[model samples]
Target: MSLDTSLLPNNIFSLKNDEFFQIIKSLVGEGLCEILKIQSINSAENLIATDDIFDVFKYDSEELIDIKNKHFFKLQNGQYLVKTGIKNSLLYILKLLKVKKEEQESLLNNNNHEEQLDTKFIINHPLLRSLVSYYKYTDHIKNNNDDKRSFLKIFIDNIANNLSQSNNHFRYHDSVKQFAAVLYILGGKNPGEQKTGKKTS
Candidate 1:
């Protein structure tokens, strides 16, 4: 489904720019991309428990337990819903790049590092390549940097493109746009659209 844009929060971009980057950094640093890859394989809407998550990402059992306690996974009808959001979408892109959380964190920390982000993994990741190509086409108005793109732009474009391609009944471009609206609100930017005033069906 296409997003109306008018159905999103007005203050979705309220976060400071640095805070936005920090959120992105934390998501990448904590292996969120790997988690998202697993989720994508299994189906995003499928209710999965901690055991399921552990099997995919191999995160420490203790940490998984803590995440459960934090209500990251919502309980509905005795089933735990997998967490879904922009962060998960961004991580999925990173997973396609074969970028480890450590590597992403290191890059975030040292913006001036001469090392280049390896795109070799993209050769084997057709879907990721497609999504990245789509993102660059739709999001970039002008080419300022050489071959590199910012993590934020990549994240947004990937999510937008992925949502555009989703065939699932519950997954739609509008949902992804709403997610972007939330990010903008958190980042202290004034989102253009107003709330839908109606609950999501």
Candidate 2:
């Protein structure tokens, strides 16, 4: 159970061990505390870079995964909305109090387990995915029937077809991106590389 956010007391000494964990949990639940290890990131930071996205999942902590689903953490835009005062207040308490020896041993053991699960850090970032998908499309096209059209032309044509399929119902501004996504298919560099992926809506 979490500590009631409204009923917080000022004195850390007054809280029990479980209550301490509860406060920490309230500040940043589950494995999110491990995020502090990555370049000493604090919970209050507003933006998370693409490269650092993997670090957030580096440990594959089930706790991290659980809390990540909370609406405040918008992984889609690489924005994490941590609660106010988390860094200067309760998080400082974590540093102030020494962990029990048994808990320390348990954490070390968990770290070893986390180290073995490398798949957690594999990012679903845009550039990597675009490269992968583009290459796969090229490989498939190359292996099958010959086509004279260039890769850029082929993908651009595909984009055009998709746009026309909806009778150009997509808004003019959004259609701009729908058309632009073809350049990623044809190996364009960093056209708003980190976020927007819209097949529809």
Candidate 3:
């Protein structure tokens, strides 16, 4: 039971311990204080109520199985994975901030900058454009099972090459390349690498 300090006198020394404890029990009901074992010295301890405690066996057995089943659901689809890889690849090209870009020279020359250049196109850089192209190509090959693994290897290799051209780009790029390599090794074959198995999605 938590006591309201305001209920007690500002000078606690004025009241006896017994008087303070009686006032505490009166403010909060009887059993509530019994749930907390208050000592004569004003120090209290919680006594775990063994009689009213819940038993583990009281829950339905099916509830335990339902919890175990939830672990099997994961989000890793081929199209989504490819899209994510392209996004990560684009991050290496430039520092993309939330700020929007606008045409400066044309706007200064005349107010009609809209006729000369698309304002939204200012955000498009070479690297981002390349990544967008790769993402679209990956989506295009969704049904062509024959060369899926090859497609992924080529995509990852392209990113790795791009990283190599820039200063220490491959440092972070190598990790992604390694991931792609692992996936390739673990039944991650190109379109023609494996002929017998069902195609990966």
Candidate 4:
């Protein structure tokens, strides 16, 4: 079924300039990380060109051109680069995911059961799926004791800390909460009740 864009806020397409930049930066960084996993590259110093970033994200030429025109990306001497460092890039992605999760929950709450199904499909869009994949990859790294595991742990801790500080009782989408559950299972424990912060085996 097609997604119901009408449910989204009108500002969805016209995000603040800074917000738009951060989203694209985060996406590019995540895409590069996936490419590094595929190529077995351990060093972050190796610069990724525009074509490589596009390939990793499976973006067609038209999409690439569109993104460039939107000023969310800059191609410098044929290489794609984010002004924000990798850590910030990752944090931005986490922030974006949190926003999406809350948005999805709000839509579900205000809609009928039949309409909620359409909301679920919209929440499963490719961009969110890619974020889920990134988290899954991080979980794998943590499990296997990879060299990058320490960095991934720090990233997760940063996200958790931020969430704790927000003090907002966000109702995340079911799939997003399920992903959190999977991460907990990978860490050898059952997931807690997210709202209550209590766990049961």
Tell me, by lDDT, which candidate is best. Answer: 4
Worst 10 residues of 3 by lDDT: 93-102
Off by over 4 Å in 2: 1-63, 75-81, 98-201
Angstrom error at residue 71, model 1: 6.5
Candidate no. 4 TM-score: 0.21
Q: What's the best-to-worst order under lDDT? A: 4, 2, 1, 3
Candidate 3 lDDT, 1-201, residue by residue in tens = 232344434433344455544543565443323322222233211111132211322344554333223322223441111123223322321111101012233445676666355444634567556656766776687643545655565666776677658666544445456766678778667643546766666
On a 0 to 1 TM-score scale, where does candidate 1 land against the true structure?
Answer: 0.20
Candidate 1 local lDDT, 1-201, one digit each (tens):
232333222322342344433443443444443443334422222222223443432333553554444324645644444456534644453343233334545766676443333365665789879867866774666653433544445555566566767456333345456767889789865576446543344
Relative to the true structure, how large is the alpha-carbon lDDT of every model? 0.46, 0.47, 0.41, 0.49
Instruction: Give lDDT tens digits, candidate 2, residues 109-182.
Output: 99987876533332446655565566578777784344433545455555655776675564344445655776
TM-score of candidate 3 to 2 decimals: 0.19
Q: How many steric clashes does model 1 contain?
A: 12
**CA error at residue 144 for candidate 2, angstroms:** 99
Clashes per prediction? 12, 0, 5, 0
Look at candidate 3 and tell me the lDDT of residue 200: 62
TM-score ranking, high to low: 4, 1, 2, 3
- How many angstroms is residue 155 displaced in model 2 relative to the true structure, after the best TM-score fit? 99
